[model samples]
Target chain A: MYELIKNLGTWLTSGSSWTGTDGIAHRLAEHLQYSLLATLVAAAIGLPIGLLIGHTGKGAFIAINLASFGRALPTVGLVVLVFLAGGLSMLPVYVALVALAVPAIVTNTYAGMTAVDPDVKDAARGQGMRGHQVLFQVELPLALPLIMTGLRLALIQVVATATIAAYVSFGGLGRYVFDGLAQRDLVQVLGGAVLVAVIAVTLDLALSGLQRFLFRHRTA
Target chain B: MTIDWSWIGDHTDDLTTLTVSHLQAALSAVFFGVLISLPLAVVAHRIRPLRGFLLGVSNILFTIPSIAIFVLLLPISGLTRTTTVIGLTVYTLVVLLRNTVEGLDSVPAKTKEAAKAMGTRPLRTLLTVEFPLALPVIMAGVRIATVMSISLVSVATYIGDGGLGQLFTDGFQRDFPTPVIAGVVLTILLAVVADAALVALQYVLTPWKRRRA
Candidate 1:
């Protein structure tokens, strides 16, 4: 363990490791691009579908079952499958990561929207609010906490899965771990593991804080 | 770039072997996860402090990416199924434990009181009443964990212990799409099949819930 930590220190401190095309910064950028693109795409697709289904109380079956189905489709398998079909590029990785992410967002959005107090929604309607206004102004705010929760879950999963994109010869922090494993370099493997963990932790904490911010209105 | 159907068809034996291996690795994790989590969940449900600690630990474990967990364990267990299963089991613990506690907690207080008022022993009341009532929700958690384990076992291929994941790696290396596509479909099917079976089991166990009002 000491030896592993020492190697990681070497990897972290070395100038070459931190710069150039194959450097940590480059890999970090690659990881972030995949994660951000996947998250954006998933949110764009999931939030709308979730809000629509959730508001109407329609397609509950699809919303609920989609979560399990997404969970079941192995992310790695999906990555490989897309790579085979779409060619060997980061697009396959993005598609796979997006698939992993969308379900959580959808399910949470549905649940959050559904869980809003009916009286509150009825009041919004009983007032002069139009349908879209009621949905956007009242329901969305009420459901923000849960929606944020879903986003947080999806983001973490995407970040985690993006690491494995390295397996397909894509650039990411996972490349460090896999490349290290190939060469029997424990330092590289641990360095990559630590970096991914840091990303996951930071992302989760940020989302949790956002969830709290969204939630503040609830009790107030 | 295109699939070779004949290649996949000729590999039926290989497919079955891989499927069973995947099932074995994943299911064993779920089985032991339940065994380990149920008791802890049961006790934790009634004890608020313990509940938080258990959930906190499991949640932290859950955050560790699947492949990271496997790689983290590689040093300790050295690329064996032991490391893979342990990693898988850790992932299942949070899901199972939370579901178990939630299901048990959802059982009506009145029902427990009624069981006790009937002169039933506490342990028997818990076994016959609380557990049966909790089974449906608990099964839901089991379904999630099982599906997750099945999906994750494919990632375990990195450590040389992939179940259907081996097909994925092999297909990629050999420049063949057949095994890769087959592995993807089979993994998804395994998840769906397990979920359906669990749903059926839940219905069987919770006949009261099935009755019309």
Candidate 2:
């Protein structure tokens, strides 16, 4: 344990490791790029459909089934499949990340929207509100917490899964991990692992804080 | 740019071998995951104070990306099936443990009281009344775990013991699309089949709920 920590400390503190194109900054940026792009795309696709289904109470069965099936689809398997079809490209990585993130967002959005108090929505409609007005003004505000939860979950999953891009010879924090593994550099491997864990934890904490804030704001 | 579907046909034997082993590994993980989680979940439920900590640990475990789990386990178990299985099992623990605790918790309050009033011991009540009631929920968790483990088992190839994941790594290494597509297909197929069977099992187990509905 001491050895692992010492090595990790050394790898982390080394001046050369923190700068330039091959450094931690660049890789972290790459990691964020994949995760954020996937998240945005998934939100674009999942949020509206989830909103419609939750609002109109239509096509939920198919949406639920598709989301569940999405849960079953393996991230690494999809990454590999796309990587093969596309051949050592960023396209597969982004596609895999998007596929991996979509289900959580869709499911959570639908659940959140459906969970909103119908009487509250009814009041909004009773106040001369249109369909879109009731949805955005009432349902959307109420569903924000769960929707955020879904986005948080999806983002965390994407960030973690993005590490696999290194496995496929793509550039990211995973390069530190996969390359370190290949070279038998335990320090580098653990360092990379710790960094990825840090990213996940940081994002989780931030999202949780956001959700809590939303909850407070909603209740107040 | 093409799948070379013929290549898949040509490698039927290899594909079958990978699929079966993948299923075995994932199933073994789920088995061990349930075994470990059942007691821990029960303990957490009964203890009350420990509930938060147990769930927190499991959540943290779940959050640690799958690759990191396998790699972290490598020092202890090395690049072996033991590591891969342990990694997969740990991943399933959070899902199953949370499900188990929630399932038991969801058992009706009156049902417990009835069992107790009937002179049933705590353990007996748990066994006879609470557990049966919780089966549907717990089984759903198991279904989730099974499919998730199947999905995650693809990353276990780094430990050199993964089933279909080996095909993916091999395909990527060889720059061939056939094995990659085959592996993805087989993994998804196993997940769907296992999930469908579990859903069926849940339906069979919850006949009372169905009748009420």
Candidate 3:
């Protein structure tokens, strides 16, 4: 056990820590940039679609089904599909992440909008608030919490699934985990896994904090 | 690149076999997950400290990458049905445990008091009052777990385990889009069906939610 601890300690302090230049950190950053971009793009597209579907109140079933279908498309499978379709670069990764992020955002946005207090909406309209004004001032603020919940879910998923980009040589922390497995390097593999868990938990906490900050008034 | 319909047509048997296997794995995982989580949730509920510890542990487990779990388990257990089931079951724990606790907690205090006032035994009250009230939330957790298990089963292909994942890995290696597409399509279909069935079950179990609807 002491030997085991010693080895682990050495692995942690080794010069070749996965985050060294040309290593895990650089790769992770690249993947994160792409994943974040994809998720943001997905939020841009999905949030509006969700809001529209919720407002019209006619296409709830369709919107929900579409989102479910989006979730059903496994990230890795989508990546392979894009790879086969002659787009093997980060484009495939980005597209897959975007696709994966859509369902949660859309579902949450719709739910959040519809859940706004009917009385508040009516009051806004009674006060001569225009449709757009009511939406921005009354609906959006009320719905923001749920919308943020969806975004948080999407962000966590994007971070978790972005590791799959390693399969396409896009070089994320997944490289360390997968390559470590290939080489039977438990230290590296465990380290990478630990990093991912840490990242996910940290992001979750940060989002929870942000959600509290944004929705404090409502909760209060 | 043109789409290949003929290839998909030719591999229908293989596709069906893979889908069946994938469904089998997911169902088994969910079964075991519910089995383990329900008891654990009950224990945690009875013991507040245990509840906090287990909840944190499960949350940590939930964030651990599915691939990492697959990799870590494969060598220890070897690539077998047991490994896949165990890994997926652990994955479902976070969802199932939370849902179970939430479900049980959702039962009204007045309802429990009524049961007690009627001189119902502890076990009887749990079965007739608590469990029944918690069923909807529990079912919702099961729905989520089932979907998660289905998706993770596909990732299990990395270890040469389970059916649909086999199709995915094979299709990727051979550059055959047919099996891959078939596997993805079937997986999606299964998720939709499962989700709808669970929603229906939730409605049946909690008529109040239905009335609200």
Residue B130 in candidate 1, Cα distance off native in Å: 1.8
Where does candidate 3 stray beyond 4 Å? A1-9, A18-21, B1-13, B43-56, B196-213
Q: Which stretches of candidate 2 lie above 4 Å from their native place?
A: A217-220
By descending DockQ, how would the candidates be arranged?
A: 1, 2, 3
Candidate 2 Cα deviation (angstroms), residue A96: 0.4
* Candidate 3 residue lDDT tens string, A1-220: 4554466577666767655655656866875786689889999989999888766677999887776577567677778777767656788788888888999899999999999888999899999999888888888888889998899888887887787787777677777777776787766666666666668778887888988986777653
lDDT for position A58 in model 3: 74
Query: Lowest summed-lDDT stretch of 10 residues in model 1 chain B?
Result: B204-213
Give candidate 1 regions above 4 Å deviation: A9-16
**Tens digit of per-residue lDDT, candidate 3, span B190-209:** 88788888888777777766
Candidate 2 chain B least-lDDT 10 residues = B176-185
Interface RMSD over true interface Cα atoms for each candidate: 1.3, 1.4, 2.3
Which CAPRI level is candidate 2? Answer: medium
Task: Give lDDT tens digits, candidate 2, residues A1-220.
Answer: 7777777898898989979987988999988888898899989998998899999999989888877688778777778778777676788888888888888888899999999988998888889999999899899988888888999999999999999888777778898898898998987887787888889978887888877876874662
Q: Against the true chain A, what TM-score does chain A of candidate 1 give?
A: 0.95
Ranking by lDDT: 1, 2, 3
lDDT of 1 by residue, B1-213 (tens): 667888888999999999999999999999999999989998899889899899988877787788888888877898898988999999999999999999999999999999999999988987999999899789988999999999999989988998999998898787678898899889989888888888888888888888853
Q: What's model 1's lDDT at A163?
A: 91
